[model samples]
Target: MSAMVDTPAPAPHPVPRRTDGSSVPIGALVPLTRPGWVEAGRHLLAGIESGVRDVNDSGGILGRPVELVVRDTAADPRRAAAAVEELAALGVAAVAGEYHSVVARAAAARADALGLPFLCSSAVLDALTDRPTDWVARLAPAQSHGWRIYGEFLLGAGHRRIAVAAQQSVYWASGTRVLREHLAAHGGTVVEFDMDALTPSAVCDALVDHGATALLLLTGLPEPAVSIVRSVRGDRRLDGVMMGAPAGQPEFGTWAALLGEDGAGIPFLRYLPERLGPLGARVGTALRERLGEAPSFVAFEGYDTVAALADLLGTGEVGRERIAASWAGVAVEGTRGPIRFSRVPGIGVRQWAWPPVQVVDRDPAAPGRFRVLRTG
Candidate 1:
């Protein structure tokens, strides 16, 4: 009976390779549970996963696989800081991926304190990278740049009286401030409306009363933006009015689907064009397969973040200091275009100096499709 006890060799326990001597671990700090931003987080996560896969397929960094450690921040600044600290404790070589600008600020501070390389994926607040830290860099263009481009578009559209439906978030506040200041400089009258405090109908009424020729819907949440658009569409007084939003959910196909006919003729700033070059097209195709829609700007930034990390960590021990040093002059082709960072004053100190951006509107005839109106 004892001889018949042929217990198969205990299946080997798959030990977690904290460091494989070949595998590089990167942390993705995204807002997976944020009330209105979960979809954005999912798309960003998908892009990150796709980027890692591509890196490994092309003979991973230093001939080792890339591993991703994802953490949710719930779109909270404090939670974002905690997530970064935990990722650092887990010995992640670097950290990337944040959608909320406020959360990105907290995470960047923690990453700097931990001496870990943190490449911000999509947070656009100007303060996120205002000062150059050896440990922190950004892949997304600053909000100021995008706002300036938006201001130009509005001016070109002959929108002299603009009303802003702004959310109460720091990102929206700062973005609207820049936009307002820019428009004022150009002799355009600007007025702000609290999106949360007023109903969509009330906001539209106020816009009409104020003789606002354009309505800038800066609510970062898609639902509120859609409601406001619908309200405006119902009001004949707003006919022929130029309505637009900043680079938020309006760039997502899901938002267009929700808006349906209401989305037509509304313009938004988009970082990536619908059509991409070779590298961008490859990432776009993968994203479409995973997300069932074209990749949004956040998704493109996520993929670029991981690709940049792989380039910085190529064939070496993952050290934060080394990664920071190597990142200073490195340039890689990104989903949007060639990605590069530089020390620029007024904007982020070590941010993507110039990322491609464009203003796009939903195609009137083609549902869920966008047409590029202007490029930056």
Candidate 2:
């Protein structure tokens, strides 16, 4: 007597393909991050590698095998530039990946010097675009694009006096500026507060004295946002008004908990939904399967960069110049949406605008988990 058990077949791996029905190894460059960031970077790379394997197995880019080259920037600006140089020295047709904007700017500059096209996965600081580095392209849209959605959400909710909390980081500063400018255009006055400007006590006083009914937090790291909320809560001024965008790691539930009732009415902005849209879902699933976790918009950006390079390689010319030429109109289905680069360099060509304003919903099932109440 035998018990029959069905074993599932393994999923097909991605392969990079060349135009002539041959396989070529596509390479990538990853940044060195601190412990936490490194782990996240690994997740992003794993997803891209998985997609590469899948692409290879399914008849790859034009028909070449995809290969990944990893380097650690150690989260240091100088080291990041060196990493890019190393990747460039390897003669990788194009390079992709880097989460931090400062790191990206350095690496992008290096890639430009070497005549290599740089495609960054995260790096949303507007300064990344202002210089117009011909070597760069980005997967994620600028915070301005997403923050406008946050401002609109607040205005739509009947809030006119809004206070803005910005971080010292490049992305935070630029985004805060854009948010303030736009809010003014919409008849809302913004009282700006730099996270570095005030202590917890001073921030609490400012939030109350400023007469702001709505709070806009623009920063990459969650620490500042958490601190601001705590200050507001401790002062007994938390009247359930808070809003923010990707405070770095992409998880806001814990931050929401710290603020408690203050977080109840708080809504964090997200350009990409975790469940993902039709186009993003496929990329997300494939990425999760590879990374053993869900992919962030950052990781999706990495995938798109490689996809763009892969398309360029499919032209049958494998030099850096040919890659650059092909890059002009390069477009691919990214985890976020369709990605394309403008010839102007730093400005991302096509960005999907689906900034979902998720209000903190206390889940009964999880007890402390925050769920999304409204998304638009």
Cα RMSD (Å) per model? 10.3, 11.2
Instruction: Name the top lDDT candidate.
Output: 1
lDDT, residue 326, candidate 1: 67
Worst 10 residues of 2 by lDDT: 1-10
Each candidate structure's count of clashing pairs: 1, 25
Model 1 TM-score is 0.91
Q: Would you list the C-alpha lDDT of every candidate in the order shown?
A: 0.79, 0.59
* Candidate 1 error regions (>4 Å): 1-22, 315-318
Which residue runs does candidate 2 get wrong by more than 4 Å? 1-32, 35-40, 129-134, 219-222, 246-265, 273-279, 289-293, 343-376
